[model samples]
Target: MDADTADIATIGHRIRHFRTRTGLTLEQVSDGVGLSQSQLSMIENGKREPKLTVLQSIASAIGVDLATLLVAEPPDERTAYELELGRAQASPLYTALGLPVVRPTKGTPTPTLAALVGLHRELARQASKAIATPEEARRANTELREWMRARDNYLPDIEDLAEEHVKASGHVSGALTHREVSVMAKHLGFELVYVNDLPKSTRSITDLENGRIYLPPASIPGGHGLRSMALQALAHRVLGHERPESYAEFLRQRMQINYFAACCLMPRSAAVSFLQEAKKDRDLAVEDFRDAFGVTHETASLRLTNLITVHLGMRMHFLRVGEDGALYKGYENDGLPLPTDVTGAIEGQLVCKKWSARDAFTQTNRTTELYQYTDTPAGTYWCATQTGRGDDGGFTVTIGVPFADAKWFRGRETTARAVSTCPDPTCCRSADASLETEWADRAWPSARLHAHILSPLPTGAFPGVDDAELYSFLAEHSGPLGE
Candidate 1:
């Protein structure tokens, strides 16, 4: 295409690309820009060029700078090597490797090995005068990759160290809520957006070059208070390294970081050991596990589920109660059967009654039930249980662990034997029914589980730690929790 046609085509591509990336429909964009949908379509198809006023309006409507729509280069004129170099430059992995494009020069000593040289040295040289010679660059790339691998491998220990540092600085404070942390992140270049009704126990953190943003479970549709607690933990963990980026990329990176964080905090080996120790003591109790591992209750419960489901051979599930007296964070492991196909609670009332009663017991009638109270650094959990066989003959265990009064489990024996039978007659075989409707409802169990679960407690909960200490702890532990 000629220069004029190429410019128009580029503009068209930009408009379409931005619109699709932002998830805006043509009609919606057209209405916002005061243009007919057909007209917008023509412009995007490059059949016609929009007037200056129209271009300005389109840019404004789409929330993009006008220059973004105007920048364009003809495809035919673009150098293939330059494009390849561009791709390499945009990749975080490649950038971290310190590989830059190079241009051959008369007196310049080039690496004899083809793989050691970048595709476009001229572009790289123009881009950065500080780049070293070919040999130096190659060595640097190798060293950088090794460093990155080491960092990724040791992230958990690094995070623990960071957290310790923060604690020692005495900067921790209860008033430093997630919202406040989010606001601080925005000041550092992150734009926090909430995604309502997310599934339970699910969260993500995105690293957008500008900064990082965390999507707490509470922001998800079915999230509970635990979601907030998780976010709080994360805020403390990744305070210093939270960089900002564009919105979409930010969400993507946050998820990647969150997964890494989870893996780091509860490494597969540590989880297995913790579960083995807990099982040996017959103490699936949160307090017992917390003391054994020196973690908060929420961390312990999460670790418990991970252990039972991921590490152990048993299938496991979890639920947390919300303000509406309903269950949230209904999660199940791969080996177990899900009570139902839906993501939320099956029955209307709380699901813990099946195991909460004193006469309730465990069975293998394709289903087993148990009730127990768990304590965490955050609070106490009144949990109910159900286990059933899946279609493939594998077992699925569901536990509805709800936040409740800490006193409820006060007198319950930590080493109590499993009950033999469930006394509730209204219970159903359909796993689809709500816990409240399936069985005879009983009074909330008295508190039996207790411990300082919500520890390194939010700032005000402790006496000596200050904001500096809290920030320092988070920065140190930003990478991972346990090795």
Candidate 2:
């Protein structure tokens, strides 16, 4: 059969399966769907193609989604709907409800579409359930960070999980090899396939039922980076995260997978031993960790932050800044002053140019570490920064600690000291005198609008997902909400 005909037949089969599974007779389902028994029979027999609305009604009557019925197999419907619902819950209206969204399981019966609509109606009647705010993103970050801090940024459970995985793979204490990743994928019944036509934001897509993972080669770096990315994808399946109920939960899930990936790349015991040995003579350098673990600078810094904060009892802040001095990413369990928006967001805000995180951009050598001491309104902080220019752009990674805590770091002896008066109008390091005098009339740098910054505010999982796509999703699911 042609693919379209086969699809219709499959959808028809699903309708019948769900109808029988739910123990609804043709007459009963037809009555609920506003269709006669004969018409319903025709649809279930694949004689006629149901319209989208008709399909939705059928799905609702059967306590499922239209997309669920459209899947080739009923067993896979749960997974597919979960993936879609994950994106759907990111909508501001759903998020504002603050209800824990649950995915329907085979054993747990879902209410019919009408019942769910009634529930939504009751919720709306009691009080409006919709409140959209940009600060939701900030709140998510704060929640996840607080969770990380509560555990002292150490995840023993995930580390144990990774250790078990590594033991099963017959590999001990080192970066996972490409051959090992492939072996692990096969062991988990997954076939790895590479493609080039994935969305720019997507590095990989997993099809659990099909036991396939689609990796976009161009997006993934080579060597150890590739192995790390592959292991991360496998880690998601191994960890078995449910669909996230909130943006904060989504961030937490991502971080969990990240921690798992880092553990796989640099096993915790070995990393700790190495750090302990290295710290005996010299302060910890991010590059040393990167080289030892065969990971990138960002990965190394994150690993160091996790290791020191959780294992060593040292609280520090990590930063990634672009050449333009925009804060790309940051995490702090330490009480250090970092840049923030009015909403207290760290990402996308401009870092103080005098800060080591930004000043490293001015250094000619991108690889060498640039350490500085800055006295902000909060307190003096010593930071070690290194810049790297890649094909994409130039960016710097910095690890900083409060001045009182700087004695533990290797770069604490650097004479590059700057008294930064940030977030204060009367601060000594204002750009007005030097920068304006040198190029006020010459440089006309326009403020750039980065849509990705706002994209994460609405979407839970992936940044840069167009808002219109999310709007369309809401419109499609409007019937489920009784809109």
Candidate 3:
């Protein structure tokens, strides 16, 4: 059957149902509709599709409306069972076994049909469980992203929690200070302890029994990350999180702690006020937001995604694409077309070479932020991007909104622009036709595997965190602060 029309088998069952319910036999309805009994029987058996006019006449002959025969659902439990049996027989799962197809008649038992469908469902479930580790991670990320998108990526409860913690720390200022972080830790009955040899697999570890949060003495540029790390460690206790049972739960806890830390670093009320004032003046910029919060540009950009659409009514997207144009992280409520896989994950997918996230890496002047307007299949979008280098390499932090909302942003007037028909091979992904014509027959380049490509997935409740190492570090440090 054509996809546009109802499945012929189900339709046939419905017609049979209405015909029998109206006390009409095949011969009687066939004669009334000007068709032979054999032809009508073929139609009833789903061996042939009747013309629309023929179906109409049959409906009229059977004392029913034409619409009654067009529904997709099987008319009865028996009909549903018959349909599933047929589908299973036609499936590769049964056929590949070289077993005879089971054909049932009116004499077939419903219990047998129920057992077959149940077996098929279990087989499919087991098949899906064979997904690889990377695929599982991608699925987890995709689910979490959709969850965030549904709530506009804003959790008022988490926001309120962070706000309460910040207030309890007596914070009224520019950036959340290290001292304030210690105070916040203490308020939760934990003290911050600086350490030279924290566990390599962990960022900050909370000694729940000892009531001490162990952190590294070193900090990121301009002293930004320590407070967030401290708050994240404290958050595990405050949020009452247990060991995650699955990758999805682990991802949820990670995002919650990250969001809590971000809100602590940049309290929502003050951040919203600052954004509103900037938007009012049409001077909203990521650099200024980063400076105001004294946080990294990436943190400010991500935090903006949590606050902007809900508070200022502006939809935007955030990206952390690497120097090689592969997207490392992405979030969007705006209609920017990102390259996504079947899992709906944008991470590890390459963006268009022309995207600001990729192009900003080529710019010489890293001192100033890069801005550009990109014409995508979704629409035009203007983005402000800042490039920075990390231990892994260089990447860009980009925040963009639709062209209509660009007027309220500081970089709206940038002359730098490009057109991207991405997710299409012809759009920056494929080589020029002439170039491809020349090279396709001649080249056989070996691809370099990315770091994550071949690495074995880390296992445990917390995927990458080494539990034995974490416990040892905590036990060693739990004795005394100086020790």
- TM-score for each candidate, following the candidate numbering: 0.28, 0.64, 0.72
Better of 2 and 3 by lDDT: 3
Q: Candidate 1: lDDT over CA atoms? A: 0.44
Over all chains combined, what TM-score does candidate 3 have?
0.72
Say which prediction, candidate 1 or candidate 3, comes out ahead on TM-score.
3
Leading candidate by TM-score: 3
List where candidate 3 sits over 4 angstroms from the true fold: 1-132, 218-222, 453-456
lDDT of 3 by residue, 152-180 (tens): 89999999999998999999979989889
User: Which residue runs does candidate 2 get wrong by more than 4 Å?
Assistant: 1-133, 199-201, 218-221, 390-392, 404-408, 428-446, 456-483
**1 versus 2: better TM-score goes to:** 2
lDDT of 1 by residue, 388-419 (tens): 23233332233433332212222333333322
Clashes of each: 75, 0, 0
Count clashing pairs, candidate 1.
75
Candidate 2 — worst ten consecutive residues by lDDT sum? 125-134
